[model samples]
Target: MTKPSLQILAVTLCFALPAGAASLSDPFATEAVTPPRPSPQAAGRSAGVPCAREIPAAPLTAIDAVDLTLCNNPQTREIWAAARYQAAQVGVAQAAWLPNLDGRLGSSRLWSEQRNYNSTSAALTLSWLVFDSGARSASGESARQLLAAAVATQDATVQSLFLSALQSFYTAQAARAAVASTTEAERAAREGFSAAESRYEVGIATPADRLLAQTALSQATLNRIRVEGEARNALGALASVMGFRAGQPIELAAPPAGQPDAAFAQDVAALIAEAEARRPDLKAAEAQVRAAEAGVDLARAQGRPTITVSAAPTWAEVDRVSANGGVVGVTVNLPLFTGFDTTYRVRAAEAQVDLRAAQRDSLRNQVALDVWRAYQSLTTATQSLRTTLDLVASAEQSERVALGRYKAGVGNVLDLLTAQSALAAARLQRIQAALDWYVFRATLAQAVGALDYSLLEPAAQGRP
Candidate 1:
């Protein structure tokens, strides 16, 4: 009787089990436990990517394409070329310390009586700055400073060009992403339209629903077309920046993968410090200050004595005749005070020094402000990228659920369409967020006035 009662109880428990319970002969339970879906990316992709890098891009190397474009740009090249010329001027100023030699050759014929003489003269005049106080020395120093400033200006030009190139590269890549995004949206919309038509045929969905889906499909298709066109334009712009013809293929070289992360928290201050240390423009201003000091010295030296020596020798020769004569002399002009010319020049030089010093201080403040702003931008972009990535993941999961529901006839056409639209928006947002982080990183580099050559590709090297 006890065994029979236990068997009846076991049978009763088995019969009372819910149909969908995990333990009750459920085949789909294992399938439902499958892993989470992947994030919307070119299979095996990750978040906050510095930029989508291709193998073709790796060959560009940091030095080749970028360096050459900045250095070799016909318009930009002039800045460096002019810098060379300014440096040469330093040599000219140094020349004052050396003697000058002039050679002359001439023949003169006279028609007057005994006093008139036919003559030919050949001579060299030599003059050296024996002393003009410190004017020569001051001028030489000023010229050297000017050359340094010019070189700094050239550096700034190169930096500016590289920043522009980076902008173009990122812009084109963004457009590329946009085209892909829009194309997928169009495909999703068409699928939605098809789904809507099938539902309407079964008398479940309204005709208006099918029409709405079709309209969305048309709009998505148009948007894709526009985005594709924009991609072409962006590519052209990138090519042009590379010193290539518009419409040329701008092979984007992958920069070393950088991500906007909390790593910036501690490093942002350091970046600001780098801007001060590495920025060439600051050095240029400092050079001007030194140049101004030299100018002051130059002015103060005005009344000082400057000794110059000159000599000329002459002779008369007849082509077929006999008599000849010659004369030789040395001349020197000592500085004579002319209404205190030196004193006024000294005053002017003092004024210039004050003005230039003020300008240098102002520039320093401006640079500091720029550094601060760039740091903030980098931080903000980094945060935004993280948020967008999370959103994409959520949207992807939602999209999968919707797909499953619609196929099972439990979800309506509207649910499927909305889910698809949301997924597209999420994907695009993520793409844009990734691009923003990269662009802000480039901006941060530019603000600091220094660039890591290692991060650049080979295609960017060699401006000369």
Candidate 2:
């Protein structure tokens, strides 16, 4: 009889337990399985479209590249997302100024001394913070400043992306020019080799001359191969920056023919001043400083008094006897102590303000340095461009004379080869100098916070 009674008591206790109580069979329960979804490419195919297909094969220009990058690049999208998230934070801060309402319902059963009783209750409450020593106002201001910073950050990202696309586009163009130059050199080498062979067969040129010409041809061929590879690599880089897969086919328009912008020739000090005034990063830093200052104010305000008003309306039932009641009250809460937590928080916020100010100063110094460096680089490239143009003309004239004399048996193969090599080198230098000038111009624009897709357009059209 005792064993039966104990068993019955255990069974009663198990049934009385709440639904949320742990069960012995929990670890043995079968896990829920989720069905796998199709991959993105497969899903696209199912939707009657393909992923990673080539875009319309238009002649891509620097401006087109910039547009593509801004549209497709993940960095730009990521920054935009961040800006949206910060905007949401601003909304959250604003919500604190509004009233809050809550509703709750509860049921209970009590058993004592073999007697049972049941009760049910429901409540609807409203709370409105009438005052908090300007804490809400400071918080809202801080959120607004943060949102401004995020917008500035997005602007800075756009400029940086434009500069990157510009570099890749110009690099691809330079590589293409290099391939053309090498092809010209190879043609000249082939002509020289043919002349040497014909002269040797006629007993006018020695075997050494033929060998020298052959060696020149080989060198030119090798240079062409190397430059062709470089051209391919540069194209791949351009495609990547334009937010396409590497090795995507893209035909680029010829770069515009123009000197560096007159703006780049301005005084470095003036450039620095412009950068300080216009740089998006600097603006973002200033906004951060403002936000940090607001944070300090918010922290200090936390130690002050808060005033709130609340109302509650409730319904209750016990053993089928029901009653309705309501409450309305006003309260004041003064934070007299919190183990010095508020004091520490205020100090930390003040330190953060100082840190942001320091960062802004540091960024200003960096901007000045960037302007100085870009100014020097642009000047050097401009000078080199003029010198290389002269050098190419002189080398070409010398090569023609040497080739003519060799064909007439008056000049040696060595002199002809020498002139050919000089012309090739001069051509390559001219191409590199032109590219450098363009790249440095973009760099200077970026340093002055003037880099934009409009700036990449043809200078003859108008400067942005």
Candidate 3:
């Protein structure tokens, strides 16, 4: 009989619970089934690299790789995350337009020698804001502008990070080429030394000549090893930037092998103009100024009036006794002197507007400076590439002449070794110049606000 009575009471209580709360089961009664966490090794990525979901068909060259494929890159994901967070901001601002709703419900039964009673009650109330001197509207607009700025900031960061990754990858490639060139030169020198030693043993070449060949070979070999180590470090740096797995392959697609296009505009003036109009960084900053202005309006509106309506209903039962009642009305809150606080706030808000405007103006000048500096780097890189190309061409010709002379027995071994070293240096300088041009152009692109990444390219093969 007691168990049946308890069951009856439980059923009554479940039916009388609030609409939303009725569905809320006893959380403590349910055993939580948690998903297995990923292994630590599998979860950590490089400090800043994005995870690329799919490896590309071919190796991705610096200029051809995706900006930030987050499969392996966390930084890329971080930039994109701002847009997602802004969604919450939208919800917060829009909340003002919706009516606030609240509710309560309860049920109980009791029987005693002196009394027997059962009671049930439920209430739903809604409150809506009627006026606030446009404060709500201003606040909503400010939130909207801030959301836009966040999106813009994310875009700008994405562009900058991807461009940086691309450049770092290119630098590593050039370093690899430099190491290869020096290694080959060392091998050639060692072979020449072997030949000279053989000739000296046969009394056909002087001991001085053999010694000179040995010295050159030793120096070349040492240089090769050092440069190869440098290349390895460069690869490591690039791997760090990619945020890929330690042993993961990072193939690069070959970039277009043409020289940079002809100079678009002469100097910093044109570049500054372009940045002011197009740069995402500056655009985001300007948005802050607008948001701040709205903030000032909001603070001033606090000195005015606000209208709201509130309603509440409640019920109580004890020993089978019960009572239920509710109240509903509108409220108008008026501002009065409270230590001249509102007056001070108004003054502060006006000063903040002035500060924001000044900051905006200052940033405009700073942006111009950035554009000018990047533009200058691009110009210098162009000139350097031209000079390095000429140097490489001359070294190639000289290496050919030395090789021919050595074969014909007219040139001393020292001349051949010297020419070989010069050719190696020239080749490395040319590659470095090309890499500089590539990176600096990307920088200039970012500064001038033209940094749209084409997601079409995939990472190429053979990079690990």
Error of 3 at 414 (Å): 4.3
Per residue, candidate 3 scores C-alpha lDDT tens digits across 328-391 of: 7898988876578878887887787788778878988888887788778778878888898789
Q: What is the C-alpha lDDT of each candidate?
A: 0.66, 0.80, 0.67
Local lDDT at 332 for model 3? 97
Which digits, one per residue and each the tens of the lDDT, describe model 2 over residues 1-464?
Answer: 13443354355445433345334433211111111121222112123322233444887777667666666667866887787777767756766876677779999997799788999998767677889999999998898899889888877887888889889988999999999999999999999999999999999999999999999999999999999999999989888876789888888887676644434455678888999999999999999999999999999999999999877777889878888877889999989888899999999999999999999999989999998998898888878977887899999999999999999999999999999999999999999998898888888888999876446545522232
For candidate 2, list the clashing residue pairs, or say none: none
Badly placed stretches (over 4 Å) of model 3 are: 1-52, 62-64, 67-72, 106-121, 202-209, 254-263, 311-326, 339-359, 403-414, 453-464
Please report how far candidate 2 places residue 198 from its true position, in Å. 2.5
Model 1 quality (TM-score) = 0.76
As for model 2, its CA RMSD to the true structure in angstroms is 12.6
Among these predictions, the greatest TM-score belongs to 2
lDDT of candidate 1 over 217-253, digit per residue (tens): 9988998999899989987776676676776555554
